[model samples]
Target chain A: MKKKFNLPVRQLATVGAFALFLLLGNFLMAKKIIGLYYTKVLMVAAINMILAVSLNIATGFLGQLPLGSAGFMAVGAYTSAIIMRKVTFVSPALAFPVCIIIGGLAAALCGFIIGLPALRLKGDYIAIITLGFAEIIRIVILNIDSALGITLTYGASNLKNIPKTTTFTNAFIWVFIVCYLVSALMKSRHGRAILSIRDNEIAAESCGINLTYYKTMAFIVYAFFTGIGGALYAGYLGILNPSGFSFAKSIDILVMVVLGGMGSMTGSVISAAVLTIVPEILHAFSDYRMIVYSLLLIVVMIFRPAGLMGNKEFSMDMLTGLFKKKAKGERSKK
Target chain B: MSTFSLIIKQIINGLQLGSIFALVAVGYSMVYGIIRLLNFAHCDIIMVGAYIAWFFMTNFANMPIIAVVASILGCTLLGVTIEKVAYKPLRSSPRISLLITAIGISYLLENTAQLVLGAAAKKVPGFFTAETIRIGQVTVSTASLVTIAVLAVSMVLLTLLVQKTKLGRAMRAVSEDAETAQLMGTNINGTISFTFAVGSALAGIGSVLYCCAYPQVSPTMGSMLGLKAFVAAVLGGIGSIPGAMIGGFMIGLTEVFVSAIGLSTWKDAVVFLILIIILLVKPSGILGKTVSEKV
Candidate 1:
């Protein structure tokens, strides 16, 4: 009875903390204590964190490399942007959330269709097939305007004039939800089956986990979040170009997942923030920075193959442990 | 121009493009057969080879032959060095790690090239004489004929090398089972290096041909070309030589035909669509063996 009473208190406190962070951040931006430029960077970082975390579900937990994430993002982005364009009758507050949902659903549907045939192949073949699918999507989007003889996407010209409804507060709320749902899922029985599949596919199959169902579930979930992230990106930018979603962009998100410990959500968030911020700060050494970044990736893989956190999440215990003399022991061992 | 001549001209263009793709795809197939790596950096080797050839030919201006040889040698050396430095220590690690390392290397090369050479596309002077061979309305360049001829020679030589050589036996044995091959006294490191050497050399040849056909060298030229060649390799059943050649030609023709029929913008889309269809129908590809996994 005491533990049950504590649970609600703890949940209320967490909600209070989230609310505090959101309001504080907004106040700082309003007063210009935090510049608009930095605010934009923070929002971009939040979106990237969402992308990295979503991709981790498949690449880290499910153990598949589908390189068409940018394509799914494109689907979500264009869908949401187009829907928002059509629904000028509704209030911005009412229409924004609905558009994001529709965008995510569209991408989720795409993920299901593509996942069926693409997942039949294993490892490198799956990677290549997904890449093919991404390329096809990009090309279709690029040529669709001319093919249809209409201005649906505006094709290479870029879709513009969508209202910028994704603020920092709203974006972080979505990020919080995505992170929470992923953690909750991974803690459930279904998440155990997904983890089992990643650990050993053949063994998981023998154990009566329907391989296709779980694999598709991971993919669908991944697609939905990616779409939500993309929807935010479209709203933030106020423009949507097919060129924005490319193979290189997919690799950029993958780099974040790799730089972080793939199986760890906190690692994805921290690395995503650092990567987004650092690049913006080092705008002068742009070309040389990429050289350094690639070298970092290589050296990191060689020296610490599992990544910075090595599949471990950061927790309060970790911080408290550092204060204790027992900190000499690797906390990862637990 | 009549319709028949335009079609014939397009066929010739396809053949020339296809031959270059075949050379690169063979390289991809050979390396993948042994290491099971996509070898993402292989494409950058082609770009480097083009740059090296451009450097030599521009400085020397008289001996195009020396430029070709240097490009090939540079590619081979670079390929071997990358394998030794980046890949060697990770042999026992997970495949995903190896894959990530490959991606890092690819980015490294492309970025370094961009930093050093700048991102502007360089126009390569015609290595061959600007002479055209024409019969009726189909006019083909001398370079196109040379590319086709070189492809035929390379295929025959490569087929003979893989089928009849001692190194070939070692390669076959290793790809089949590395531990067994080592137990049977094959030098695993040497065999892998040799595979990289030959594959990079093919990429070098492809670079020279690509420069001839496209007549431009840029830092990112290899990526698009490499991606297509990789697609061809997969379409042909990755590890098979004949399959790579056939897949390259098929891809080249399909691209040409798609564009020729007035869907020029949809060429890339059509190519990927075909790959998806074929992969779905036959997961192992047209000529790939469907090896059942053993628990």
Candidate 2:
């Protein structure tokens, strides 16, 4: 009877934490503590957080360096933006979330197509191929409207007047949901298998873990969120340009993941926020910002290649251990 | 011009473009061969070379040959410095880290250029006198002919340097197994630095040729050019010398043909598409050995 009453402790705790977060978020927004400028900044930060965490799934966990997250994002952004524009019957609020999901699916499809052939190769080949895919995506988007004789993406001129359905609250909710889902996936049996593959591909194969299936799965999931982030980005900006989703954008996301610690979800989230905010804070130093970013990347890789968090994750165990140690110290002093 | 003359002109243009790509691609291939790094910054050596040449031409002398030599020396120094300062410490780290550091170095070079020189594109002074040669039916640009001549001469010189020189043997040994090379009393650092120097010198000459053809220099100019050259390197099987040259010409020809077919806007896409197809269909690339990894 006691064992039955024990319940799923972790799940219960997660739900409670989520509820608390919503309450706190509501209070902050209601009180206007996070001003308009901060809200906009936070929204961008949240989108980056989603991108970084999702990219972590591939580069951090699966140990594959995919340089095409922006390509997937562009696909999603265009898909969602077009859907929102064309589907006049549906309400903007309802259509927005649905469009984001559809956009994610579109990106996932692209990921499946690109990943099949790309993941077959190892190391830098995957990087270059993925990079090629990204450039192709950007170029196609840039030239597709001209070729097709339609204003789908408006070509290089870009799409203007996208319905602004993405708000701070909605973006925040999505970021939390994505972070939760990714972390949950990372903790599952499938996550362990993925980690094993990263640790040693040959060993993982010998142990009967299917490489192709898992690699594609990771790529697909990563692409899905990248697409969602893109859809949200489109709504936030109220415009879309192929140039906005270039190889530079992909590198920016990569920098976040690399800075945060590839294997740590929390690290990615924190780094994403910091990186996004740092530029805005240092707006006066705009020209030097890229120089600083480049120097930081080189310095970090040289000194601490593992990144800020390394492979260690934040958990209740760490907190409890700290509290227990403090209590024991006090007790001993007494 | 007649259609046959037009075709000849396009082929000349392709050869000129191809020569630049081959020079840059050789640098990319050599670096990748030795360090197993993509060296994302390798292409920026061209930009650095171009700027150096431009400075020499505008501020000092309009002497093309001296500018070319000075730019080549400048790029060699920059490449060696980057290898020593940024990449050397992360040599034993993960390949991804090295790759990211290379990207960092690339960004650093580009941003520095943007800051110092401004972001606008500057016109490069013509290296050679504007002259045209007429055949029986077709006219050819002297610049294109000179580019091809320079490419041929450089290829011959580079081949001899790699095949016959003691330093070339050290580079080959380091590429094969650095640990073994070190055991055999090779100065590994010197060998790697030499490789960077030679590769960057080629990029320097490539910059001079590219500037002669296009006559424009910008902070971000190296990016697209570098990407194309890197694609050429990969298409030719990444680690092979002759493969890079062949791949460079193939890319150049493909781009010219694509534009000739009136898909000028899609030329970049087509180049990237070719890279994807080549990677998928033949990962080892043409002229490359299919060496499978063993546990």
Candidate 3:
């Protein structure tokens, strides 16, 4: 079966096809065949992909539920937004990466701090604590805006005039970087350790995998990318409101991850893209769109419990394994 | 107001708010205890109940008693349907899958309410006229008295139901061990559906009371309150009813006191602060017993 199918060649072809599709998309956007509005939607999809994939690392791969993605995203968004707003000397080119990094680092710091204590609490308890942390961060931001009187957050004022730095090129570039980085991480030894911990914390711990250290690391890394995604989101949308990063928004991201197969990076990417673009496509049904989305989620849970792609990767081995088992069954029948 | 009066006011307000939290928390704790699933839609049940009450108050202003009874029944039915449709099928699925479904059901309920009812906040007519009773230098509103009375009655009824009734015994048996209970001739589905119905009915009562005290109801109102109630449930111990009440009171008092200290905006932070502090000190919660997870 292994010799009958060349897995590497099929893998390369799949990558090439995706690359070509991305190039064509870039070309279409550049040539204005697709309007800027749609291009902007694609940009949002890229950001969502980053968030969904990063969060999937924690929620999907690690089997740990963390509901504080929005809180961490707000940290990244505000940190980046504040720096970009306040700093005058830096050029947008240098400022962009710096702000994104700072945003990610800030989120990572929060993640590490929260994760240290929270990693000890599993399942629903961890979920609630993380949710509390998110709410606290949001309320703190609101209070800071009110108390300082400096208009730091502009107090219900939409954070405006964020130098728009996220074009399709940059958005796609960052998306690719994040997707590849996380995918590779998931395939690495550290990824194995994270997955192991999710499978059984006790056994993982017994195997000398420090539950605290690895779990915290996965959380920080997840936060870092989510932060970067948030930074991009702030810049792309050109406005940041405290309400925009509410728990509902966090749930939206979670929906994307869950709708996409949890443990599958490709599933996250596809689900994020579909979820982001679908609402726009159903613009006429705006009021009922969310209702439909929610119902769709319920149906998915009831019927397709494994999600859209399950845990399978986009690989030839999976394809050939099907035929190989079929051939064996045929021989046995004969 | 004098300092002592102010202190008394805060305490009363805290108790009033805490009672509401306690009511909602019971729903959360009971559901969690029985199914080990955090019914995110439980909060929306509160919203649905409030809407039902609002429907009654608006269209049937002259029939308050009938309206309240109908609303409770409506919410009870909604809760039962939610369990049968949304949760039962996914019982054997992974915990996260159930969580996602709960969240989806929550969103579905909220959005459905928004679609059917407009996004604007609806006014729930005051159940009773404003009248304050004075005890020496301290005063409490008639509404506060009603809230306290309602909560007390509900608690007594719930305790009686859980302790004295055959259905309650069956519920307890199922919660302790579902498979074994089935062997003992208890209807697992009926008990769970009944539990959801009762829990949601309590949430409905809570919603009506909460709306009366606050006097405004919105479609999105349930999300925050729902989260707070979940926190209360956890703080008191996930499956313990009395613990939920205590947790709710603790949270309510903490919020009221924090606000009184001129940190009104930080009230949310304070709630979480208490949760974190409590969780760190007693990971099992204030009134919760530790259950060992099988390896």
Best by DockQ: 2
Better of 1 and 3 by TM-score: 1
How do these models rank on lDDT, best leading? Answer: 2, 1, 3
Per-residue lDDT of model 2, residues A1-334, tens digit only:
1122233786688678877876786688789997788778988998999999999999999988989999999999999999998888978898999999999999999999899888888778778778888889999999988898987889878798889999877898899889889988988988998999899999999999999999889889999999999999988988998889988899899999999998999899999999999888888998788898889899889888889899777666556677878998999999
* Tens-digit per-residue lDDT, B1-295, candidate 1: 8888877888888988899989999998988889888898999999999999999888877888988999999999999999999998888977777877887898899989998999999887778766688876688888888999999999999889889999988888888888899999999999999999999999999999998899889998888788788889888988899999998999898888888889998988888887788878886767889877867
Model 3 local distance difference test score: 0.86
Ranking by DockQ: 2, 3, 1
Report the lDDT tens digits of candidate 1 across residue range A86-155. 9988887689988998999998998998888887777676677777778888888888989989889999
Locate the minimum summed-lDDT window of 10 residues in model 1 chain A.
Answer: A1-10
Q: Which has the higher TM-score value, candidate number 1 or candidate number 2?
A: 2
Stronger candidate by DockQ (1 vs 3): 3
Q: What are the per-model numbers of colliding residue pairs?
A: 0, 0, 0
Tens-digit per-residue lDDT, B36-89, candidate 3: 888889999889888888888888887777667877888899999989898999
lDDT of each: 0.87, 0.89, 0.86
Report how far residue B44 has shifted in candidate 3, in Å: 0.4
CAPRI classification of candidate 3: medium
Instruction: Return the TM-score for chain B, candidate 1.
Output: 0.97
Clashing residue pairs in candidate 1, if any? none
- Model 1 residue A204 lDDT? 96
lDDT over C-alpha atoms for residue A203 of model 3:
95
Deviation in angstroms for B135 in model 3? 3.3
